[model samples]
Target: MRRLPLAILAIALLVAGCDDAGASPAAQGSTAPAASAGGACQLLDFGMVNAKLGLDLSVAAGASLDNTFTCVLQAKGVSYPDLVLAVSSTTIDADVFGDMIQPKNATAVQGLGVAGYQMPTPAAGKAGPGVEVGWLAGNKRIIELSLRFAPGTPDQRAADAVPKVVELAKLIDLSSL
Candidate 1:
């Protein structure tokens, strides 16, 4: 339809602008650290995301392609509240994640993964009101979490940020991706 989510957000902003070349320490403004042990942002922690999405981020950046691995958390000299976690070890199913990564009217999350969904943030720029949660884990790898806020947050906080992005997507483990 709409050019497939704008061609998957233009190949995720051209693979996050080919990462490293962008000098990702949160892209030079500095602040990307944390996320070490087993990388890929260690499926997020940072004090359980500021005690459940009350966010203080404290930066953490990452990027990869050929098997996907993206982690970004923010808030150290501002850049709107941010939290993005992506993982993909290939192996997709459930009709290719409901016809290529769900999204169009998403809202089916029922037990974390093996096929789940959630939506919002289709527009709201300046990092206000957002929420997203995707799944397909049971080893079929494919996660995607999102949370944005900061810019007069409180539009019911994007429906209260959807169960806090399904409780951080049920503390994502998926064989410790």
Candidate 2:
């Protein structure tokens, strides 16, 4: 369960490098890992996304990175070129992790089917960092919105990723999974 953040980090690096791609104000980036049965969960398709968010996802071929429940979208005029929407029925319970970040900075979400928070992740290069917004729903299902931009980008662009995650979280229904 402890490996959850590293796994998330690996994904972030992938997203940073266009490689691949948790929650809680539990610390901005901290997450409590729980065990859950995999393979049974359902991932939302691109059609489920709201076009108004500027995330133009299509049901084109190879759009999905992980066939089971992961969709990767290519960015157009958007600030971030790599956007990943991933849904999972993770066993890790987020409630047990305490608070990842101070409640002040963490945005308390309501009616989103779960307790969600947004955390900014810092990177080594010039691109700055990306924000990961995640929530726990139903039993142990976790829905995460990971957004990464090109390296050495401006800090404002990195900071802009937070609100986007929250907006997308509302559009997704974790219970359906």
lDDT of each: 0.64, 0.47
Q: What is the lDDT of residue 68 in candidate 2?
A: 23
Q: Which run of 10 residues does model 2 get worst, by summed lDDT?
A: 21-30
Writing each residue's lDDT as its tens digit, candidate 2 over 101-146 gives 2133555566655577666666655444666666666656555666
Where is the poorest 10-residue window by lDDT in model 1? 19-28
Give the alpha carbon lDDT tens digit for every residue of 77-153 in model 1: 56566777777766658777878777678888877767878877643544477888877788767777777777787
lDDT of 1 at 131: 85
Native RMSD of candidate 1 (Å) = 14.2
RMSD of each: 14.2, 10.4
lDDT of 1: 0.64
**Estimated TM-score for each candidate:** 0.34, 0.56
